[model samples]
Target chain A: MRLQDQLLFNLRSLSRQRFRTLMQLIAMAIGVFSVVLLTGLGEGGRQFVMAEFSVLGKDILIILPGRKETSGGMPPLTGGTRDITLQDAQALSRLRNVDGIAPLVVGKAEVNFSGRSKESLIIGANPEFFIMRHLRIQQGQGLLQIEIDQARPVCVIGPELKKELFAAQPALGKWLKMAGSRCRIVGILANSGTGLGFDMNNALIIPVASSMQLFDTQGLFRVMIDVHSLAGMNKLSKEVERVMQERHEGELDVTVITPASLLSAFDDILAVLTVAISAIGGISLFVAGVLIMNMTLISVSQRTAEIGLLKALGASSRQVRILFVSEALILCLAGAVLGILSAEVLLWLARQQFSDLLFIAPWWASALALIVALTCGLVFAWLPARRAANLPPVEALR
Target chain B: MIQVNQVNKTFQLGDQPVHALNNIQLKISPGEYLSIMGPSGSGKSTLLNMLGLLDIPDDGEYWLQGCDGLALDTVPMDEEVRARYRRDHIGFVFQSYHLIPRLTAAENIELPLVLAGIPPDERKERLQPIIQRLGLEQRAGHLPNQLSGGQRQRVAIGRATIMRPKLLLADEPTGNLDSHSGAEVIELLEELNNDGITLIIVTHDMDLGDRAKRKIRMVDGEIVLDKSREQEPS
Candidate 1:
């Protein structure tokens, strides 16, 4: 028979049983909707984390004071291990492909400026910290390299710290007491938003030499490095490690974290998460497939005489099977369209509520959902379709 | 033309086999009007089914038109080839008027042409004359349930002949109708027969069976009587 006629016949048959058709549509739509929504959420989370990491500079690397374990979590510090010194940072800065380096010494101390005393975070680094962190001096001049090497008491304050200590007044050349030591405010940093889990606007920036004296610490906390290009990061990391190992007396006492490595680790974890959730949603589609089988069996039994009539009218077994299978494909494809539309509507609503979340279901996810739905419908429709096809026309007519 | 030789069909009723057709030998020519009359469970319907290619004989040689080689093997013929033969050469009318309930009378009549893969415009053209000849033009748009028993049977007849098959089989075609509707259906069958289509009817009504040019009586899976009013075959 002409495929158009067969399609029309199957459509009419389904229309006659409106309630059953509607129920099957709902089952399939629910299956497709769950997959779209959950995968959209997973993809959104992955994008959000990747965006945050991208903001930290793709070529930057952080070196911590311990080795990272394969089991993840925080790497334990080796006992009696000496702290990473400023000399180690200087040694790595001289390597090939190394653009710049910033030795970090972070602490919290009381700030007493103009009699407005508040406890704030202290970030201690050299003049190279500005370039490494992409920070611009918003007011006055930055600390000179000569001042950093001489351990002069000159400092740069963040925008928020400036507002708290100076209260809209010009703060350059003002004397500020950091912890127990007094320093001159040489520069004010521009208002950079919160990043890497800290508010850059609420911290104080100073020379490492001055911070070590004020905080009474001789050891550096962390080192940040910038590579000239992505191609040089791996070689530079190894070079840095080698230099650090030599400085630490043949002991590897530092953990090097390149953005590529960190992002890939996160990518692997989230990819698995995406698949796991999609599979969980796919279970519903499987259940919907079972429902299709049961419904098709019922339809076959009910339409026994009709099947006989078609066979008697010269329909072959293969044609009969194609008829039933086409019915399933039509139903599932209709449901897939409805489900995808509804999912798009849901994503729009989600976008309205959470502006930062990209609520898009990737094209492949949608395609996978559609392919899986169609496959499920066809596979599950097989047995009943074969049963209808193989029915003896004479016996069925009787 | 149709031919059957030493045809045998067996059915397993529970564990015991019942022979539905016993070594039956029959030959029918094109345009012949024949009827087989039998009591219940006497193999009348089984013979019709065999002729219609709806069933295969367990041991037989059967052929229709020029397709005799297919009957030589013990195994049944390929279903596709049989289906093609049926589409090209056979038509069937049932007692209960098996019109697809969802389709209108016109669509039901269009079924055979549709199955033969005739395009829509040609199918419409083919159906026009049959609709007028069956006097179903006014009732063409009605669904099966909306039509009376006589009208439904007419629609079934229209559907069966839409493809213009060479042979038409009607099994108890008037069984579900009142006497008046039954007579109309029988007359329709005879009219088609007179127009050069071979007609075969299976019935229990003696009067209906007697009206055919050739009459066959079957009892207990065997033919007891075969009589023809005219000696010459059409």
Candidate 2:
């Protein structure tokens, strides 16, 4: 038979059993839908986490005081009682791989500007801290080196803090009181949005010296280091560890986190998550495959006489097999198309609701879905097609 | 031409083996119209099925046009080859008519041609004449359920002979039809036989057997009587 005529005949045969065909298509759609949506969400979550980490300076490294033994466990902050000193920050800055260092003292405090008072995190660091942490100054001037050297009582307010403290009023040059100590706001930082629901722009920045004096946090510090490149991060981390070990005589504790290491660790967690999700979703496809196999087997049994007639009339076993597989493939293709469209709609709705976060369907994802659908079709349709093809015409006809 | 020599066929129904055909021997020439008549389970249908290449005997040899029927081994023929042979060399007229219910008369007639891999143009070319000759030109568009028994039988005949096979096997071709429709189907088969096609019919109707030039009677899987007209047509 002509290829076109064969296809038309197969299609007509499927149409004759519309309800069964529709059920198979629906099963395939559900399979593909689960795969697409779950993978999309996993990918979207990965991108969101990456974006949040990017705001902390891609080349930056964080060093805490202590370490956790197990992988992925949170490391304890070292020197919880004795904080990192500015001298240590300066000493780390002198390292070859280290680009810059910012020693910070963070504490929760209530601040008042004009008539408004709000609780905010206060980070004390020098002017270079802005560049080290990817902070952008929106108004006035940032804390200067001279101000840090002189221990000036000046601070920079994040955009969220500015809105809470000043509302419509000017925030720059305004006086804000923290712990009953008045400090001049030198600049208002641009909004940095939220990272995993924590608003990064709801913090206050001040000179490290002034913070130590105001919060009575002497000799204690949290130091952030910006590295020159990711390639030498491991070696640099070891070098810093050695230096800190030697400098403290093994008594001073430190925890170091480079962006590359953090990313690799995060990727490890994501890999596990992706596998778990895919395995769960894969079960759905497996179930759908079983459904297809069951339906095809039943179709073979029900259409035994028709198959016998076709065989008697000159259809090859190969042709019979192709006809049934073609039916399954058509069903899967239809379901895949519908499933993809539904997934797109679902992702679009998610994007609409969570406008700040990004959810994108990469080209590779679409290609993967297509490949998966075709594979599922073939795998699921094999046994029944074989059974139909191997039937003896004489016996089948009788 | 067909030849049969000591053919035996047995069916294993659970524990006991039932002999459906036993030591059967028969011969038929081209253009011969033969009728096989017997009571139920008399092996008439079994003989017809063996002759149609739909079954193979467990013993003995049968031949069609010098091709061995016993050792006629082609590895049980692939579906394509069997279908091709069925389309190009053998035609079947079943008691039930067995028309594909969903297809129109013309489409059903075109089925064998389709299976034969005939091009649409050639199929149409062959179909138009046969349909016109069968006086089914007007009913070509009607489905089997929409047609009368006679019209449906005509459509079935058109489908059976569309490829112009050499042998025609009819198994109770008129069993489900009225006498008038039955007579019409018999006439159609006779007309095709006149056109030089070998015909083998199985029927319990003695009157149908009498109309054939040769009649073979079977009982209990063995032929009890074989007779042919002494006066051959000139």
Candidate 3:
């Protein structure tokens, strides 16, 4: 028979059992939808996190204190003191590979504005902090070098804090009480939103000199260094460790983390999460496959006599096999189309509701969903098709 | 033409062997109308099935048109070849009619031609004359359920002869029909036999057997009597 005729015959036969065909299609669609939506969510979340890190200039590296060993066990914050100083930042800035350095001193404090009090974090850094972290000033001028030199009581407010304190009013140049000390808001940083459950835009930034005075935290520091290129992160990290080890006689207790390293660790965690989520979602596809197989088995039983007649009339085993498999593929393709359309609609609705907090599905995700649907079709239809093909014509007829 | 020599067929059912056909020998020539008559459990149907190539005898040397029937004995024929044989050499009219319910009369008639890889144009070309000859032109688009008993049998005949098979095997082809419809089917088969096609019919009706040129009586898996009318030389 011509290929078209075979396809037409199969299609016509499927149309005869519309309800069963529809059920198979629906099962396939459900399988594709679950897998696609779950994987898309995971992928979108990863992209969102990566975008958040990207906001912190690609060349930047973070250094934090390592957990120290104590008498009984390891303590949360009992590390050998690194005591990173202004001298360390100054020296790092002079390195050929180092573009700039900003020593940060952060602490929690209460801010009062017109009798409205809110607890927020206060960050201490210099003017170069803005460029090193890629922070943009939304409403006012950023902190200047002269302000840091003169120990100016100036600060930059995060977007959320600006909303809480000013509420539609301009926040720049306004005086607010921070930890019982008055500080003028020099700049309102643009909204960077939240990442990893922390609101990046809800913090206050002030000059290191002012923070040191207000918190009585002199000579204590947490430094952030920006390198000229990411290609030198490993070399620069080793060089910084060597320099610090020599300067402090190998006594400095600090941890350095490069964004690439952080990304690799994050990817490993994401890989595990993706696999776990996919496995959970894959169960639904397995169920859908079972449904397909069940439907096909029923179809084979129902068409047993017809199969015998066809075989008697000259239908080969392979043709019968192809017919059933093609039917399954058709059902799967239909389900996949509906699943993808539904997933896109769901993702769109979620994007509308969550805005940028949730990520949108990429094109490759849609393609993967289609591929997954086709695979489900073939895998699910194989056994049933074989069963139909191998059935003895006389026995089937009887 | 067909030939058979000492054919034996047995079936094993749970350690009990039942002989379906035993030491059967028969011959039929082109343009011959023959009938095998017997009661239930006799070997008439088994002989017909073997002749139709739908079954194989456990031991036999059967020949069709000088071809080695035993060569086709063990190996199951592929669909294309079986379809070609069924389309071009054999046509079967079952007791149930066995019309595909979803297909219209014309579509059913076109099936054998379609299976034979005939193009749509040729299918239409071959279908028109047969349908017209069977007086089923008006019922071409009607489904099997829509057609009367006689009309359905006529459509079945059209389907059988669409590919111009050399042999037509009718297994109680009129068992489900009224006497009038049964007579009409017998006439159609006789008319096709007149056109140089070989026809073998199996029936419990002795009157149907008496109408054929040759009659073979089978009992207990063996041929009991074989006779030919004086008008046909055999």
Instruction: Give the best candidate by DockQ.
Output: 1
CA lDDT, candidate 2, residue A77: 61
- Residue-level lDDT of model 3, residues A308-390, one tens digit each, is 66665656677778878888888888888998789878987877887775745556656766787788678767787888777
Please list the residue runs of candidate 1 whose C-alpha ends up more than 4 Å from where it truly belongs after superposition: A69-80, A94-97, A107-122, A137-191, A201-217, A228-232, B66-76, B229-234
lDDT of 1 by residue, A220-327 (tens): 888889888999888888888898999988988789998788889989999999999899888987887788888888988888899899889988889889889999
> For candidate 1, what's the TM-score of chain A, rounded to 2 decimals?
0.84
| Collision count of model 2 | 7
**Fraction of the real A/B interface contacts present in each candidate?**
0.67, 0.56, 0.39
Query: Candidate 2: which pairs clash?
Result: A64-A255, A65-A78, A66-A78, A83-A220, A83-A221, A84-A221, A314-B83
Give the range of the ten consecutive residues with the poorest summed lDDT in model 2 chain B. B66-75
Can you give the lDDT of residue A140 in candidate 2?
Answer: 88
Q: What is the lDDT of residue A244 in candidate 1?
A: 90
Local distance difference test values of all predictions, in order: 0.86, 0.79, 0.78
Model 2, position A65: C-alpha lDDT score: 57
Better of 2 and 3 by DockQ: 2
What are the per-model DockQ values? 0.61, 0.59, 0.46
Taking chain A of candidate 2, what TM-score results?
A: 0.88
Tens digits of lDDT, candidate 2, A207-242: 888888878865545677778888887888888888
